[model samples]
Target: MFRFLRSLVLPEAACEEANNSSRYENLFKKLDLNEDGRVDIAELHAGLKALGIPLGKDAEEKIFKTGDSNKDGQLDFEEFMQYLKDHEKKMKLAFKSLDKNNDGKIEASEIVQSLKILGINISEQQAEKILKSIDADGTMSVDWNEWRDHFLFNPATDIEEIIRYWKHSTVLDIGDSLTIPDEFTEEEKKSGQWWRQLLSGGVAGAVSRTGTAPLDRLKVMMQVHSSKSNKMNISSGLKQMVKEGGVRSLWRGNGVNVIKIAPETAIKFWAYEQYKKIFANEDGKIGTIERFVSGSLAGATAQTSIYPMEVLKTRLAVGKTGQYSGMFDCAKKIFKREGLKAFYKGYVPNILGIIPYAGIDLAVYEALKTAWLDHYASDSANPGVFVLLGCGTVSSTCGQLASYPLALIRTRMQAQALLEGAPQLNMVGLFQRIIANEGILGLYRGIGPNFMKVLPAVSISYVVYEKMKQNLGLA
Candidate 1:
């Protein structure tokens, strides 16, 4: 994480007082591109790119605004020198804060202790990972020079800012509700940006679900009603839905589906944080296995809390226009006729599905992002919008493929009572029944529409999220 900062600063050691002026002059000459003695925005951008420091537009604008003290929209050598000097001072202060023992070196233990005070508990090993990023000589520690060199050109003024820089991974909502929630820093939480981000995500999710409600409804219908006796392709399935309940009916269950996003996200994030703490080893270490377990447990916790809504969504989607008045009516009818247990009809399979869905989603997304960075990103690791969307879509689809059987079973169980004269079955029984009656392919019913909705859903969610973030001052 901190290693990425290395590219932002001039390669020369800025902390060295000796020959400092000459070093700055040389760097300025390099950035002046045409020897005009001034570094304009274009020159600065190209200079940074040449130096392998690819900053975002906002970051570049901020730099120009701050460093161009003359209000000329450009930087002269003197202004550039002063800017580096001030940046170094800020970096020095940040380094001192981490060197708690006043030993002039930031060790792994120091890193752990400092972060622990900030409510971010990490093991010595995790601290080592952080140190490795900035520890240029593999001394397992960072001295003032190393720290200054690492962050001299970085815009971060404090530890939180550094973390924010490192936390710059793209968070795409690919319309799969089962994917793990994004993590937030303590600073983000305290400043209330975490909630804003969540709100942005929620708004994006609502719009996406609503936009694709018809496809979603058709998926549920196929999952519940498709069998050996009935075949449902995308075209015929959509026609049947329109014929059965008119156009507006396609959004039958979308309201509850959208409504549940807040609580589910809130619970999942809170539970994930708590579970991470609990899963941390004696040294506060959390490895991949621990993280996976924490995420899985947190997901299960969230699903358990808001699971009845899942049933409601399924029921409403599969219901005819006049089958029930609304969400409340559907809930009342289910409780009255089928008892409270009916609300948890497919609880087992739903909970079980979280493991594969979350695991594979995380794995595939990381793999894809890493592959892209390794092959395509020579100067910057940020995988622009399309790359991120492509990775998210592909990863989410893989996860869906892995867990669709369980999802289909869960949907069938949720809608079992609605199937006149059909027998109710437990998770395993339903699996057996589907395999016996409809063949192996029965497990993947409605997968076509489920997949069909991914690209557009992701695109809409991403665009809406970016817009919401901009409006919320998060962009």
Candidate 2:
């Protein structure tokens, strides 16, 4: 009769479990360590310890006093469950608050601010801890789905899908060499991803640039240092480097850059090829509009991955007074002081210019190459190094002319970030300052040396890349 009455008042599941060999009652009795018919602070501490919960004495006291009604200093099963639900609710609220920008994603910046609010001032170690906490997907950025599924939705379900998406979105892909194969399928003949062909043409640029990162680093250091000291010419800069820092200093940061360059090139080039292929017909030919689209996307892809490395290389190459030791040290300090996103400084214009730069570069290169082939007899072999050099030289001149303005902006933005009180220069601010201080011509300040370096670099690079491609049957 008592069991029936209890079942009528309490939940069926709870009541059934309670009377099942008195196990539930035994648990409750164990919790009520003093047999006082309620859980007091001391009894709650003992119960929590037995359950292996790490509730410190203060926490145990707080929970016991809060949950215990009528000064009983103890909790029944219902009280225990209610307390758990409350704790879960508080945790859910806290997690939701961390999702700043309300974009269903929480970035590291948001995590840092949220930590400050929680009275947990983060050091490098603490920041790393918080980053580990929020970056559940493990790709760095904390997206909304990751946050929701991790803390709010399903804590136990495998989060591979969320992480996979994060990886896909964040890290850039350098497409396959044959992605915009010389031929296309019948279905592709209809659906127009032809722009992809042009974009994929960036593969060549990526390949070419990837090989010359050492020289590129030298060039950046030279430009940054020279421009600041009014030593504007490339020859002058090279001379100064040999005179002051020695030739070895010219190749500083080359080691770390090697690993980055190839992948960066592959991604940009693949994207350009894909874009171009989309716009072109089966013949792999494109018009002006297709050219623009392909070039833009290709430039953007290459710049994004390489930007951080570019920044590091610049710092390393320009280390005249021991500001930094090496690329890794520079990267570490930047990440610790400013965080990871600083690596992508000046990403905007750099990416924006990539398309036109790539388009014009590839277009001119192919056009010149074709013209040279025409110069040869029909059955004659294709152009040799001199002809290849001429074609590459022309292509680079055109690309540099088109890209110099944006390049100037990018350099200023990257360099200024290293300055003490240098007003944080955005693309707009840089553009405006360049125009105001140096006039429109100032935008092309580095164009002369840029052209000089680009010509030889492209000449050598294309020859190597084409030869490699041909030898490998990738062409």
Q: Which candidate should be chosen as best, given TM-score against the real structure?
A: 1
For candidate 1, the C-alpha RMSD (Å) to the true structure equals 6.7
TM-scores for candidates 1 onward, in order = 0.75, 0.47
Output the number of the lDDT-best candidate.
Answer: 1
**How does candidate 1 score on lDDT?**
0.79
lDDT of each: 0.79, 0.53
**Candidate 1 — worst ten consecutive residues by lDDT sum?**
163-172
lDDT of 1 by residue, 356-472 (tens): 888888788777866775566543334566786787788789988999999999999999999999988888898998899988999999999998899888888889999998898
Q: What is the lDDT of candidate 2?
A: 0.53
State how far residue 4 of model 1 sits from its true place (Å): 14
List RMSD in Å for every model shown: 6.7, 24.4
